[model samples]
Target: MSTAHNAFPSQSATGAERGALRGALRGARAYWEMQKRCAIIAGSVNVLMLVVFHIAGLDALALFSVGSIAAYALAWLCLQRRHNRLAIGLMCAETVTHAGFGFLLAGPESGSHYYLLLFFPALFLGSSPRRAMLPAAAVLAAYVALDAWVYAFGPMALISPFDQALMRHFNSAIIIGMLSYLAIYYRKRVVSSERQLRAWAGSDPLTGLANRRHMDATIRALDADRRGGELAVLMADIDHFKSINDRFGHEGGDMVLRRVAEVIQGCVRDTDHVARWGGEEFLIILSATPLHQAAETAERIRRAVERIAFDELSCEGAPLRVTLTLGVAERAGQEALQATIRKADEYLYAGKHGGRNRVCRHADDPGRRALRQG
Candidate 1:
């Protein structure tokens, strides 16, 4: 195998890794925005709670509220400074502090334990699932230890039944609100993830064109709903592709492929389907297009590719030019789509052998027709 061929897989893997990293960074930024919003809302709520507790003459509750507000303010500052790790750390610390202090102030019966439940979802929302695992485990351990300690040591202060009932109701409301926010956030994340996965599955990783599998699926769907309209397929291959790779190296070969795909897409109608068939080959499915128009489109694509300025792609500063060979075939009514593809492939090779830079049509080639008749 050539060095380029041997290197292509590794290059593709590296590209995928880069793409994944980009996606992860995007997800992290989105999560940070959500966390920031949550923090601001929670901070505002804490301020209101502080005022209420102060008016009600509940000194202990007011003190806890002040601490919560300070923690949220620091978290916000860290987030604004783009210190996401620090922000996450502070948020976790604040959650643990709330759980520990709330338990010491009011104990289990006053719903102080509900504050501990927020830690897991908060950690999960602030960071990726993989990264959040350790923090979440630690939070769980702290929650358990604090609960055990609180139960063993007893409630730090005795309060009236009315105050205890009010605290329980307030804590319950907060927990329920946070849970609802998490549910909506989780649903949105799931939907966004599914869309990204579908796009990755259907598209060519390098050129961003439709992949062969997606093309096959498109052809099958079109065949099922022909509506008696003419459907044409143009199979195009890069001429002297191996030579291009040999001269330009794999990176340059990739650049040429991407440029060729752009040229092909530019030549076709928006309604038409274009796919990177495999390697240097591309397939265009033109629905409601006659055989003649498909050939014309193929010619346009060939001319566009020929016009690509390859000087910038060359390491040696020598100008380079590339050409395309295409085969045009029209689907006969009720005929299998694979048969049409096969005929197009046959014509494509015919052009490759006849002269490597031209479009071939089955109806225009008498020799191919005569051979079939024979």
Candidate 2:
């Protein structure tokens, strides 16, 4: 298996999922850009705060204001380095220092005076909800402890006592709101987007079944753990499809292929997948069904295709008939997925040779069993 970080960025958004894809990228980029902006905003906020502290001759507050400016610059550098861990680490460090400095320089009268809310939006993106709360709660508790420590310390003059209590309450409300909004809205959107992307990667657009790539991926991904169902694979091809194209043109051929796709879909259970393997050929992945059952299913699709009538074409001065030939084999534990597909394709060719519109077993072709599917 490839590493998680490497493969995902190359994935394309399906037509249905463009909105979610845009939203995820936009949110992440906006969050990064916002981090960069925070340096300027926090620095300005600190400079203004320094002017106020200088008037009051609160030298410690001025010291903290300068420290905050330095921390913001360090934070900016961390983000630019693409060191996500270090960047978040800097943010956490700054959160602690700002809260502590507030308590040290001001007192409980100021509480956690350094805008604690600034970090919460970014936190919503970084970690899972269960894990995020741990960090957020840690930050909040640090602020509370610092406030308590300040209250126990010597006299200090800053915000009125009533204003301090009100600020602390407001901080608590904002934190709670952040938690609620992220859990209900942002997280749901992320999950929905992920599901849609998975479906896009897994499905064949023409027939709404697993694509060839998806079948290969799925085969490699199945675990060696307990499995109750027997496995069977069927490789199917539309009989005389090329002649149909020559006789009725490509559009009719496409229509016939589509109708055959519907017929194949109708023949199998929802659990099974019938993929358009390529032009006029399909790959059917079966679960719970053994070789014989898979063969029967393939025959059902064959008969369905043979019986389908393109009546609208009759009205248009031309009609078409389509039929399918299939090859079925059980998935042996010793055989790889591609190898099985090759085996099925050999039997499928045998069916076409012997007489189109029949099911053949790969074991019938002792010579071609070792051959590859093209």
The candidate maximizing TM-score is: 1
Q: For residues 263-312, could you state the per-residue lDDT of candidate 1 as single tens digits?
A: 88888889999998778888888988989888888888888998888877
What TM-score does candidate 2 get on C-alpha atoms?
Answer: 0.53
Backbone clashes in candidate 1 total 0
Off by over 4 Å in 2: 1-160, 222-229, 243-253, 312-318, 362-374
Extract clashing residue pairs from model 1.
none
* Candidate 2 lDDT trough over 10 residues, lowest sum: 1-10
* Residue 336's lDDT in candidate 2: 63
Q: Positional deviation of 170 in candidate 2, in angstroms?
A: 3.2
Residues 323-342 of candidate 2: C-alpha lDDT, one tens digit per residue: 77787888687566667777
Q: What is the C-alpha RMSD, rounded to one decimal, of candidate 2?
A: 13.1
TM agreement with the true structure for every prediction: 0.84, 0.53
